[model samples]
Target: MMSDVFLRIENLRKEFGATPVVNGLDLDIKQGEFVSLLGASGCGKTTTLQMIAGFEKPTSGRIWLNGKDITDVPPSKREIGIVFQNYALFPHMTVEENILFGLVLRKVDKAAQRKRLSELLDLVHLVGLEARYPRELSGGQQQRVAIARALAIKPNVLLLDEPFSNLDARLRADMQNEVKRLQIETGITTILVTHDQAEAMALSDRLAIMHKGVALQVDTPQATYDHPASRYVGNFLGNINILQADLRDVGSHVSFSANGKSLQVLNDQRLSPERCCISIRPERVRIQPQPTDCEVLLGATVTSKNYNGNSWDIGTETELGSVNINIPHHGAPTPDRGQSIVVGWNLNDMRLVHVD
Candidate 1:
């Protein structure tokens, strides 16, 4: 069965003259789902967000909201709320006034406006501080005010454009959690745009990993991270070890030669690429003092090791090339500098990606 999509973007193409910003983008967002557009800087994620918010018109595309075409709808009449990178709260207005700005613009009655204001103040946990100005509130408080203002209109969709970028790390985490909580309570379909991999992974129901002007993959965070559609998507999400290998396609698995040693990878998808490379996650590589019967072992020398709180980030020099691995520092011994160790990984730990 298919989910009832709330927002549908089909063939969404946007260009600045000859340079394409979003090239033929297609995404279906389910009702009340939190979807995120995640990519690096200049990857067209922000521009896509702007298009959806009606701040920028697509050169060609169709946007459907609840089965109605909204491609040419003006920003104000789109019934979509947008919170910008800068909260854009009126500096002179108090929290109460700021949160009520949308209501006032729409000429909502005073009684209903007061009721909504009180609900929002309680929802964002700014009850007693409603009289305070933006300057007097903390960064977190100001962000809550912005969110409340956007929600004031009770729009059909909420667009968050890097809303937490200006906060400190701790505050950012706090705000992410707060926003997620608010979304759950209100059950409002939301879209977040951010370059932070962890933020997208933690918050989104699904992620659209965009490249230059296209989404390379769109799937659940765990699925996309573990099983990336391409090398670009894999590298964009986090750290990956790309290595050269001589491959031979087997029936159910593919055999490869690395460092003049034979290794095999599972061919679940039956991928037959003309040019391919091996990708292994650093966290999956294990430093074994002795080789196990079921593992493929490589002789490596520990060139550097650094303690990064929870794990020991180790770099090794292997015959194939340099390989990096993470060893959990759970009160266990780790290899020191200039120490020879055997790094091993099972067949399931390897991935085959087309050469980029």
Candidate 2:
């Protein structure tokens, strides 16, 4: 059976005054899929979400939900649920009231409303807290109530805008897992707008990394981190060590010459014989006290070491440039500062990116 597309956005453009926020964007989201629009501030992720929710009108383009054109639909008529960062729960309303507000407004019967309220409360793990007001709940609990309220109408699409941004680090991680769990249980199409890369990676089946109102890359979180499409995407996704090297005159087996050392390119098709940038993750780099018989080696001086509980972040000043390396702590002796070390990486580990 072919799974149908749940949402389709074509040439979606949004503008604020004279500036374009979402510039000619196109996207397709599959049913029961969790897609996140990730970018920094002013990247128009929130604008795209708002347009889908009918909170903002697009300057141009079309939005289709299950083959129905909803470009001109009002917010209340869209049948889309939205959860905001601040929870947006009414301060004076109890949790049950908040969850039942939409049903009540729609003139649902008292019996049916009560049944749906119980199910929603239990779904969000707030069954016993229905009588509690927003003031009586913690940040995470309040957010759960907000989620329950959004799901009360049984929306076909759920939109979350920085849903866990208000929680602390630990609570944020916990909620990420909770949201993923609930998404699996409901099988509703979900779109999350977030500026945090970790949050996007944790929850998104596929993520769109936006930049300046354009999507630079749309792929799975692991793919985006492992094989970024551009240098900008590589830098934004995670910690990368970029080295400048001349690739001119290099043959099928391209070699990167830097710091008086040469590194062979295993995948020659990915490199060009011109100005190029080599990006490697910190975890891909291996540091040793002495150079091995490897074809490529670089000397670096350990500048600082930071212990991050599970791993150590080692900063080094290499002849090529300053680089950061992450090493897992498994009872291995920590390298001291001022120690000279040789850092090695396989050719396959390096991603050759064109530098313009």
Q: Which candidate has the top score in lDDT?
A: 1
1-356 per-residue lDDT for model 2 (tens digits)? 12477899889999889999999898889989999999989999999999999999999999999888999999999899999988889999999999999999999999999999988888999978999999999998998998889999999899999999888999999999989999999998999999898899989999998988888889999989988777878877887887756554456666667657666664444555564677788988888855474455788889999999999999998766888899898888978899988887667778765553
Give the Cα lDDT of each candidate. 0.89, 0.86
TM-score of each: 0.96, 0.93
Superposition TM-score, candidate 2 onto the true structure: 0.93
Residue 352 CA error for candidate 1 (Å)?
Answer: 1.6
Error of 1 at 93 (Å): 0.9
Name the runs in model 1 displaced over 4 angstroms: 1-3, 258-261, 291-294
Clashing pairs in 1: none
> Model 2 lDDT vs. the true structure?
0.86
- Lowest-scoring 10 consecutive residues by lDDT in candidate 1? 288-297
lDDT score at residue 227, model 2, on the 0-100 scale: 83
